[model samples]
Target: MFFEEHTGLHIDDQRYRGSGTSKANRMRGFWTVEPDHVVARVLLAMIAHATEYECVPADMDDALFADVHRIIARLNQNPSSPVPEVDAFTASVNELDFEAAAKHIRTAIEQNEPATAWIACTCFR
Candidate 1:
């Protein structure tokens, strides 16, 4: 819930705008102190560096969540990698169920999967 509480600080519509340079900078301020924010920072950097057009809130969310689903599916399908937490989180995300995602995020945090916690906070918002 640490990242959840901080979501209001930088996860606004404005943060998803522009080329993501500003958001990446803002994310640096957090990840420097809290390494979990590296997920958000890296994602923002991808937008900032890879795209020619300015980023939009809905587009960014959709692209990110779409890839999230793909990654989760790949992980879940691999018999050697049984990630039930990721499965639950992806299920919550697929349903657009923010409350359920939050619970899974809390579980992720407790499980020490900070990257998942970051993704849940950034996407579910």
Candidate 2:
């Protein structure tokens, strides 16, 4: 996986600490513009925000996953809700950058969606 291949980046530890041993347990992300930081907002969709997995509670996974999928689809098809920092980074990427794709994601996070942010940062770590 992307994370295992890049273990040298030290992103795994930053993303997960005292968390448990499940997909959700390792959702807390350590995002930044740097290679390892990974732009948290883009990560929010993966693992369905980790909220479903993180809590290990009951039935919450269903809802979280639904929301995550919705967010993912919206980003894939929509063009208006760009992430906050996308314009600045676009010049550097080939133009189809996932990093630039993170703008809408950042907006989603602004709604106090910590679970999404956590999942995003850790998903590709």
RMSD of 2: 11.4
Where is model 1 poorest over a 10-residue stretch in terms of lDDT? 75-84
Task: Predict model 2's lDDT versus the native.
Answer: 0.45
Deviating ranges (above 4 Å) for candidate 1: 1-96
Give the clashing residue pairs of candidate 2, or none.
Answer: 27-118, 32-37, 43-120, 44-120, 83-103, 83-104
Best by lDDT: 1
Question: What count of clashes does model 2 give?
Answer: 6
Q: What's the lDDT of the predicted structure labeled candidate 1?
A: 0.52
Residue lDDT tens for model 1, 1-125: 33344343444344443445575654555544333333454444445544545544545677776795465444333334233444454443356586677677777766656567778767775
Task: For candidate 2, write residues 12-66 as lDDT tens digits.
Answer: 5644544553544554433322321233234543344355558545655688867
User: For model 2, where is the 10-residue window of minimal lDDT?
Assistant: 31-40
Task: Give each prediction's root-mean-square deviation over alpha carbons.
Answer: 13.4, 11.4
The most accurate candidate by TM-score is 1
